[model samples]
Target: MSTATAIDADAAPWSPAQPVLEVRGLNVDYGAGRDAVRAVNEVTFTLRRGEVLGLAGESGSGKSTLAYAITRLLRAPGVITGGEVVFHQPSASGGPARTVDLLAADARELAGIRWVDLSMVFQSAMHALNPVARIEGQLTDVLKRHRPDMAPAERRARAIELLGMVGITPDRLSSYPHELSGGMRQRVMIAMALALEPSLVIMDEPTTALDVVTQREILDELMRLRERLGFAVIFITHDLSLLLELADTIAIMYAGQLVESAAAADLLAAPRHPYSLGLLNSFPALHGERVKMTGIPGSPPSLRAMPTGCKFHPRCPHAFERCSAEQPALLTPAGSRGKRTVACWLQTGDRVPPEPLGRPEGDRSQDLAVGGH
Candidate 1:
């Protein structure tokens, strides 16, 4: 992995209101040369200040890989072959922003910026926490490293405050990881991520293992904290329904590339891509009239032997001749009132646009269509 130190970061100016994170032409390879298997292919996106951007896709769609790549947490063999990840953070004294390419940041720079500027809440709470350590020990570790000036008593107070923020009692600070419930453990993970009060937090399926009710509770609590603290979030999950409820914007990934991105309401109401529509149809309506769950027909393509052109064409019901012959670039459509971008030929008028599947039963006035959009 490489960070863009060659760009002379100090010489270039940065916008005061620039996006928190910007990724351009990002590519990830599992191996080198002829044996390389491209996991993420030229994926690009941006995260604005204090906004929630939800990422959704089937397994192997590169959602988690993209997150790991952005945070410089990707392991060996998962090489970042190309791309620029720019992080814009406010100056130490709240002056103008400092822009740095995460890919080019050296170990020293990365260590300085990680918890203070950006943090990650991994997928598995049980695995993320150390079984042997007490909650106070775990939380205080970050304080000791990043805030060395903090006194021991002050650090203990801060740890208790963090626990209270996540709805855990201060008394639990003495308890070990195994003593907490699954939901509590996940909340602890969120607390740890927030201890430094970073500008952006990337949560990779943080509530995947919890029960539905517990998951919803954790998400609601997270939203409350976000509103209170004003931190941007990149919430990665395969659950579209959860995103529709919480995210400000949503992006759908298919076979390593973004297929559609729009405001949460717009994408739910009128998903432009066939894959997005199929995914919407796969989930049952929680409140509306019950409908048959219709999953996408085929499985995701393998990285080693990916299909030519649009990787999703083979599974897309609306795909045409051009889809298999040539790939489509993501671009904004003509009638989109907002910043809605999609990678479908039909939307770009390369083919006659088919009528979108009608709204799902029992919720005609709602923003999404589960029957098929």
Candidate 2:
């Protein structure tokens, strides 16, 4: 796997014009009534045009559910209880941009928007790809449906171009999914996602099973493609370290709710949430003085019988009286230096905050993530 020249996502100059997608108070439930468990609870975020927003958290954090809900891929048992998902798109008249509430779009409306304006790359490429169909067939199937007027020769050419963009050779287009390696399959998934030239791409841990070197190479290629295509991304994964390098901004999810959202640099330098700090500490640093690796204490709270007050109160090292008494709402406090939105009582600043033990405020998150790969 060969890596491409990469642009520093944080160092890039980005002018955020209008959000391409705005998800407001979106809630998803597994069942109905009392038995219902909220998989995504009032999750809110905005993805600026051509920006990469990373959603990071542990397993069962509802990142995948949020992706499915946004794409309207959630099945019957998974019902969206409330909130709005607005997608900003160019209008037919090419005047002011058009806005469509994805949550409210009917089946026909959604079908038209799905592959045309937005696309998703699922986690398991092996499972998502058709074992019977060759790569060329799968790639051209998208074009044939979306571009009915396209000639066969044109479709074949387009498929070849898509494969080349993802670092795959045109000759491999005839090979079946099983014939390709895991990394190659993942790249094919990415190519398929981009087949329709969607303005936004949602990827759900597409490189989780690949080796670190392969992961870096794939990410480099993906970033290279994004720069060329100018597509916004909503990348979902548990690796905050990867997001710190690849994403412009990151949002941390805990127990189906957003605990913190900030610019990647800001979050890495000064994380306000304890869970965020814990997650950063879980991964080992590739450079700098390496201490013993520490794991996050305990497990995520069970959604069925959610912990009262703060969901992470049970295992929070800095938990106090208020943590178990009242749930904290995501808020930006006075005198905050970063674009930090934290849901911890320690961050509210109204009350005297807990001291970070012996660690300096600026060094805490760094201690966890300094020189992290």
Candidate 3:
């Protein structure tokens, strides 16, 4: 997987000005009627072409649910109740781009769009991979299904190339899922996801199971491939610190709703929402003084018995009267530096954000430890 011999066929020229995916007022629920518990609530965000949008939050924060909803991969009991997901497919010859309503797309239409236009790298490699099948079969299987035009030999060659792109030796293509290391299995999943060079890749905790060193290597390889292939990514993770490094734009989710979204640097320098601040302070800074880690107080609210007003207000230390009385909309802060938005009353008007909301001015580059799920 040297960059010099990389394949460029999947690198479709795209206009960065146009968004690749737009999720508007999306909602997902489990079961039906009153028994239906909301899993994703009015979540909205835009992912630009070739950009990395990171979705960070605590475990059971609807991160994976949101991903499944967007990709229409939700299973029984899970249903998309409302909202629209629009996918923009760029013109191959630089003409007007075509837009597809993902929510309205039938099975036939989705079959045409998936793999070629959009793909996903699921969270767990061991569970996602087929234990009985060989690595070569699994990798080539994707190509065989989607790229039917390719000959048998071509598919095999592509499978080998895909494995190599992620730093796996071609000789190991014959190995089964159980035969490979965790990192190797993860890399195989990545290769399978990229077999067709999708325009957008939804990675739901892609590196959760790997060691730190292997995680770095795989992430580096992924970034390199994204650069060469020109694809966008929705990176879902619990590690806010990791998103600070990988994502261009970061959206923080809490209790099934988006509490804040901003450029990665802006969030790092000055987190506007108390939940975001709590998340940052919860980790130990890699370079700062020995400060005590103050994790957020109380567990997340149960979907069946959610709190009134803001879902995070109970856990937010800076919660005020207004926070408990009215739900704060996700709106831009007054005099915000970038395209940052937070759902907190403190940042609504002239009121100053809490002192703890921001890192010290002297150490804005406070690298925090990556928390687990």
Q: Please provide the root mean square deviation of candidate 1 (C-alpha atoms, Å).
A: 3.3
Q: Provide backbone clash counts, one per model.
A: 6, 0, 0
Pairs with backbone N, CA or C atoms under 3 Å apart (clashes), candidate 3:
none
lDDT of 3 by residue, 67-185 (tens): 99988899989999999898887665776667777888777778877877899989889999999999988988888888789998999999989988999999998999999999998
The lDDT ranking, best first, is 1, 3, 2
Candidate 3 regions with alpha-carbon error over 4 angstroms: 1-13, 92-94, 358-373
Using lDDT as the measure, the top candidate is 1
Give the Cα lDDT of each candidate. 0.86, 0.85, 0.85
TM-score for each prediction?
A: 0.93, 0.91, 0.92
Where does the lowest 10-residue lDDT sum fall in candidate 1?
A: 355-364
Error of 1 at 368 (Å): 2.7
Candidate ranking (TM-score, best to worst): 1, 3, 2
Q: Candidate 2 — worst ten consecutive residues by lDDT sum? A: 1-10
lDDT of 2 by residue, 301-331 (tens): 8889998889999989989998999999988
Candidate 1 is scored at a TM of 0.93
Candidate 2 similarity to native, TM-score:
0.91
